[model samples]
Target: MSSSAAPILLLALAGFLIGGAYSTWKTLRWLSISLGACAVLAAAGAILWLR
Candidate 1:
């Protein structure tokens, strides 16, 4: 569970960034956050499969 927590925390942080970007109307920031979320999900999936 500890091992899984890091990527989940990252995903949550990226989600917050996305929300903040949306509020500020920053397109690049939103895009970066979207990518960050995707990366986090991928990493989490990989970790789950590996485990």
Candidate 2:
């Protein structure tokens, strides 16, 4: 894997983990929060990749 991709992947992973924790506490809204986190991570990664 390219070094540049590594940090983005790590950001995604961190977002996922944080989402998991967030969803766990607020069960009713878990999916939205988790998916939102993933989306945000992807967007951030894309922006960084473009730079």
Number of the top-ranking candidate, with lDDT as the measure: 2
lDDT of 2 by residue, 1-51 (tens): 997787677677667766665666566576766666776777677567757
How many collisions per candidate?
0, 0
Worst 10 residues of 1 by lDDT: 18-27
Task: State the lDDT of candidate 1 residue by residue for 1-51, as single tens digits.
Answer: 686576676666656655655665555766766666665665576566556
Quote the lDDT for 17 in model 1. 59
Give each model a TM-score. 0.47, 0.48
Candidate 1: list runs displaced more than 4 Å: 1-27
